[model samples]
Target: MPPTDGTPSDTDVRASTGKKRIPKACNPCRHSKVKCDEQRPSCTRCQTLKKTCIYVEKPKTAEEQKIEDLEQEVLVLRQQLQTQRDTESSIVVSQPQRLMGQRPPEITSPDSNASLNHSSPTWTSDKPLKRKRSHFRMQKEVAVPDFINEGILSEPQALHYFNSFFEGCDRYVPIFDGSDGFAAVRLRSSLLLNAICAVGCGISGDASVDSRILHVRLKRWLTTVILSTHAQSLETVQALLVMACWMPERSLILAIATRMAVELQLDDAFDRLVNLSISRPDTPETHILMKSARTWFLLLNLEQILQVDAGNLVDLRIKGVRRCRTLLNRPFSSRLDARLFSQVELNRLRAKVNETLTSHSDDLLQAVQEARVDIDVWYQDWKRIMEASPLSESELPSLIANLTVQRHWAEAMAACRAVRATGVHQVEMMSPEAHDMLVIAKEALQNHLYVMLSQPHYLANFRYAMDFVWAKCAFSFLLLLKLTILLPDVARQDLLGQGRALLNELTKSSGYGSSKVYLRLLQLTIKKYASRDQTHSGELDAFIPEEFIFEWDFPGLNLFSSPTGWDMLFDQYMIGDDLFVGMDI
Candidate 1:
């Protein structure tokens, strides 16, 4: 079957490449790029395609691969030679004569990958120090998603923890803008992300992250951020507010944040709010402005409370309703915002009342009347807000109600303190501010005790709420003690019984250790007085003990002795001083 001109049979057709006949690939199959398998006869592709298979005997070229192999060999030799040099240098540095006289110190090569800059301490010895690790560890290979910050959390984990914050905490304070860009910016800052997640874990009912570890990390970062030159970010201020609300032992942080906020002029940003047309609700720029505004207000909200309780003059004196109404008319007027506005106003008045009480003016009566007028106006405005744009009774609203009642009772107590002094046993003969003090103090003290004793479970709120309520309760008890004999028979016995019950409950309760001490003081004082009064001739004849000195705690603080006009320093020192040293603000 061979062709006439010495050609091979049909199976050998189309198999030539240049001068060589191809053996491994059939010409047709090789052109189509399928496997030829180099079988003795026909390969699978050649058989399937019914084409000719050819064989070539020339060797293929491997020059480029040979050069790559040589390069790799040289690199390995260089590394080995460098390592040998390092070993020799180390050996020379640690001669046996040097080792014989004293113990040898561990020598580390400069090329070692151990962390040299980490502040976590390392104990140097013959053995490596062991470390205890819990759930979190830094995986150097893991990277955050493009928008997220570098380190500690992968994309999925960051998303998972952020949801906890949105669900639990954001309901009360709607500060975040909640857009995609906002989220990206939020996750991009490592300092802010740690703080936000710490607060989230602290509040989250279902969260498994160890909140204490994250909280400790936040405090460490806070030291670097707060005192740094770049501490002007609004999110940083917001995180501070969150910590001030939820964290225990926040006195130092709270003071630093307040000073930083004022230095940054966050309070002044309120006046420059853009018009609604310029700050459209959906725009990114508007969200930035709104967040700034909210940050300013939030600082005011927190600082007002702290300043009042700390016996400092109000740093923020903006009482005009027109500005808040202007803001409300623009892009921010939810019920939550309205309620916060009301509270900010109310707390400012509280600061003024606090100023009057702590102001040791020679004209004390004049100061009291001025403070009383301001307080009456504050109450009127609160009533106005309630009737006009009343918020629904959410959990925060109920807490605000409790705060209002405490403020009312506190103002009454302060007003009576300006008028008179009397022994604990003597009040009925002349009723000046003396009688009013007993009545006001008794209501605040007696009612708080009875209600708390009856419920016994209301102390389980976040630390902010419980701190406020307990302080009010303690102040009430101390006021009644100052005029214990002046109290109605019913009030005295009720406090005695309820105080004992509270002490017993606190023994099993997770309340502050400070509260336990405060209640015991009250209970012990009442026991001594009650036992003596039982053995005395007349109510007035029982001599009040001088040992029963009045001392009580304010909210979130240790016991504050009676005020002696420390607020005057605010006027003297803070008039025009700027504490910003190297900071841009």
Candidate 2:
């Protein structure tokens, strides 16, 4: 948000160095060489003198200004495309009068459902269907107007969703760097814009667009566009990766996405970016190249997770990638690059743990110990870097710190599962390793919740809130659910109470779409078993947490392995294709 400085601002706040936080001076103060009490609509001197106060407007972040520019460009392009279609078809289209002058609804999109009203402009469809009149025959035709509603919705709803995503999610994941800022750049960039709209719609938690139907249409369109495209582009790969996060629950889409990423040489792009970083300064090309690393690393991270869950080999091989080794060691040019570099390193640690546990059971214990040390070192280094930078001023620093804590927790859980899977019959409930693992999970959940609650401001931004919040909620619930069964009655009740509070917070209060339904599903799952005597009997069989960490897909979560299924509930949402099942993993 650019600050308006027509007057003095809040000059009271000062940094530790005694520098005024509001440094911008009024024009009168600047000319008189007097210290201006950077105030609001007017400064103290301006108020006293009855003179006009003019302050320099604070510059907007490149990410924001750029997106706004792109949005404008997209709008222009849409209008031109509309005109072109009309010209080609030899028919001019006219918009309805009601829509021409009406103000669009305010759109606020986040990755998950938080800080959102239960209803949004996106949820309600007020437009009447239009029938296309044929030239020769009086045939009626209804087009798929819904296809680009997000793109062309009068208030530019897609712009809101797009900006919201960059604000909340892209900072954590830098797929959309401002290097490609112009509307022209966006226009030429294949499915990038459309894919962004798709993810925005998915995470916005708006029910206005039929997600199930749009999911199919978007996937089909994405596939069709990519297949016919003769060129591979960073935008296409970036979009596919975004969808991997947006629609993660779909295994087949991920498989196909993995293939698309490979075909686009995302890894090779990472390699090129690494060399470019060392060979050149932070020029335009280098900046873009670095962003491609973020895209590639994200793909590797998701692919690794899916592979671990499926017990298949993730096709990406980063170890041999020359840039993989040097990218982290080099000085980061931007916050996005630094954050992405940290994620790549973290995912590498995860992949190591998963690969060892699955491929070499004989070495699981040894490997887990080593991986723990590696992750700790990585976390410490990244923590230091984060503290050293301006990121400390933002929620990202702690948000990621909590994520790191959670990742370690997932590692502990996987280690516990590995111990059991590796025929550790000697390990009893009272065994030190088992107890240690349980405590680790408990501590992780506590710290994760602490971080989340500590930063209410971050969670308040519903647009980007969904992914991180959703992941945290899902992971915490499962951990607490597991602990509910594992702990003694008093301790179990305490954990259960917390779990209930968490569910109630989202289900009863949160107004975002799907949150109530999702939380209710969790509550019912707990209810179905919370009362059974067998549940509190220290039965370990009832507590298999999803081993794959960092999974928050709407279609994925499954509870109650008790023959009864939650498929009926989930079937209401979630859409995907299954043609890529046999793809090489």
Candidate 1 global CA lDDT score: 0.50
Considering every candidate listed, which one attains the maximal lDDT? Answer: 2
lDDT tens readout by residue for model 2, 44-66 = 99999888887655556789999
Query: What does the lDDT read for residue 24 in candidate 1?
Result: 59
lDDT of 1 by residue, 1-585 (tens): 344332343545433424445555544455555666777576776667666655543443498778889899767755764565556444412122211111233444344333221111242333466888779964333221221343545556556656756653553354554442336545545555666566555545334556676667667667666545434455566767766655655556666766766655556555544454344544444445556667677677666665655443436667574366455534444445655666676776666565565566455455555665675676565555554553433434444454455445555545444443222233445345445544554555555455555554443332213234444555555555444444436455655666666556644542332343444444554444556433332222222212122222142111112323333211211253332223220
Clashing pairs in model 1, backbone N/Cα/C closer than 3 A: 22-54, 22-55, 23-54, 23-55, 23-56
Alpha carbon deviation, residue 159, candidate 2 (Å): 2.1
TM-score of each: 0.52, 0.58
Candidate 2, run of 10 with poorest lDDT? 93-102
**Per-residue lDDT for 33 in model 2?**
73
Model 1 misplacement above 4 A: 1-188, 203-210, 227-231, 247-251, 262-264, 274-284, 312-314, 319-322, 357-377, 390-400, 416-431, 444-470, 477-486, 495-585
The C-alpha RMSD in Å for every predicted model, in order, reads 27.4, 28.8
Please give the CA lDDT of all the candidate structures: 0.50, 0.51
